[model samples]
Target chain A: SAVISQKPSRDICQRGTSLTIQCQVDSQVTMMFWYRQQPGQSLTLIATANQGSEATYESGFVIDKFPISRPNLTFSTLTVSNMSPEDSSIYLCSVEGGRGSGEQFFGPGTRLTVL
Target chain B: AQSVSQHNHHVILSEAASLELGCNYSYGGTVNLFWYVQYPGQHLQLLLKYFSGDPLVKGIKGFEAEFIKSKFSFNLRKPSVQWSDTAEYFCAVNWGGADGLTFGKGTHLIIQP
Candidate 1:
């Protein structure tokens, strides 16, 4: 299991402001992912942050609204750009277990509330 | 296009009672199933996972889940409930891709002592 940590555990921001959430992993991983959990809703994959490459986003999400950067193997960042009230959610970062394990270790998650 | 469905939204049980939470997935071909538990103010933890072979898989905290391929269902069960078992349980699936895991709506379980 990987020890993952996210910065800004909880934050309240005004609408139209942007907040960047950071994810740091204890070990080097090839695959890092971002997910969102709205109030009383299930987790939805936002994007896959590839080391040294552009992130691959899901269908409903786009790069403009949620830009991601993965400069190295152990760190990644997801920026919620031009936020709105609807963008308030818990953002989590996860790393896949190595060697085709298919298991993922998740971060504590950044709880963002837009006012 | 894959999706996971959790049958119960909320369940309140007494101590020493049996517990069962149903989960079903809509996907064809090979897939991996997992059960994750999230206690209040804590991050998600993997309870158990079923990749292949045995249909029954045991997890931490004396929780277990069975994966029935024909029914496309992986239901979690516990013989006796404990007050500490109160948490939100989520069922997730991965279909051998880079898309990441798709999760269910989650079932909030409450065990009253």
Candidate 2:
């Protein structure tokens, strides 16, 4: 297991603005995931960040709207572009220990409110 | 894509009472199941996991879950819950050998002392 930290625990932003959420891990992990959870809703996978390569986005999620960058194994950042009211949610960053059955460690999450 | 469904939206129980949360997934292939607990204002922590070998797995805080492969269900149960057990429980399912998980909507448990 690894310690995951996210910057800006919460933020209030106006519509049409963009915000970047950063996730830092204590150690290197093979797979780093980004998810979005609406208030009282289920978690939705946004993308998988791979070190030294482009991110793999899930269906219905576009790279232009939710761009992800993983410069290395220990760090990744997700930027939400052109925010809207519908974009308000708690964005979480998770790291899996290995491929198959290892437990995942999640960050504290960033609560974003777009008005 | 794999998806999980939690039957209960919220549950309330008195201290020392038994607790069970229903969770079902729609994945035909082999999968890994997990239960996570998130206390108020805290990060999600793993309660238990079922990877292989055993259908019944025990986790921390006296929690256990049975993975019914035939029914595609993994329900969490605690024999006797305490007041401190109040938290949100999420059931997650991961595809075999996959890196990410698909989480249920979550069940809010309130334990009254």
Candidate 3:
């Protein structure tokens, strides 16, 4: 298992503002992912942050709205740009346990409430 | 797109009763299944997972889940419950790709002692 931590555990932002959530892993990892859990909804994958390349986003998410930066294997960031009330959700970062383990360990999550 | 479905949105059970939470996936290829639990005011913890080999996989806290390929289901079960077992349960699936895990709408369980 890996210990993952996210910065700004909880934040309140106004509409049109942007917030960047940071994810730091105890050890180097190959895959880091960002997820969003809206109120009363399941967690949805926002993007997969690649170590030196641009993040790979899911079908419904876009880079312009959620720009991601993975400067190293142990750290990544997800920025929610031009936030709205709809962006109010818990943002979690997760790291793959290891190669072929098919397991992921998650952070405590950054709870963002946009008003 | 791969998706997961959890049958129950909320479950209320008394202590010492048998428990089963349903989970079904819509993927047609090789997949990995997992059940995660999030206690109130705590992070998500891995309850159990099924990658391959035995159909029955046991996890922490005496929780277990059986993977049935034909039915495309991996249901979590515990023979007896405890008050500490009250938590939100999420079912997730991964198909070995660049994509991340897809989760279900989670089941909120309340265990009455």
Mark the 10 consecutive residues where model 2 chain B has the least summed lDDT.
Answer: B93-102
The Cα error of candidate 2 at residue A86, in Å, is: 0.6
Residue-level lDDT of model 3, residues A1-115, one tens digit each, is 8999999999999999999999999999989999999999998989988799999999999999999999999999999999999999999999987656557899999999999
Q: Identify the candidate with maximal DockQ.
A: 2
Q: Is the docking of candidate 3 incorrect, acceptable, medium or high quality?
A: medium
In candidate 2, which residue ranges exceed 4 Å CA deviation?
none
- Each predicted complex: what DockQ? 0.69, 0.74, 0.71
Cα distance off (Å), candidate 1, residue B4: 0.3
Scored against the true structure, residue B71 in model 1 reaches a CA lDDT of 97
lDDT string for model 1 (B1-113, tens) is: 67899999999999999999999999977888899999999999999998889999999999999999999999999999999999999999988744589999999999999
**Candidate 3, residue A12: how far the Cα is off, in Å:** 0.5
Candidate 2 clashing pairs? none
Residue A37, model 3, lDDT = 96
Q: Cα lDDT for residue B75, model 1?
A: 98
What C-alpha lDDT, on a 0 to 100 scale, does residue B72 get in candidate 3? 93
Q: Tell me the tens digit of each residue's lDDT in model 1 across A1-115.
A: 9999999899999999999999999999999999999999999999988898899999999999999999999999999999999999999999997656567889999999999
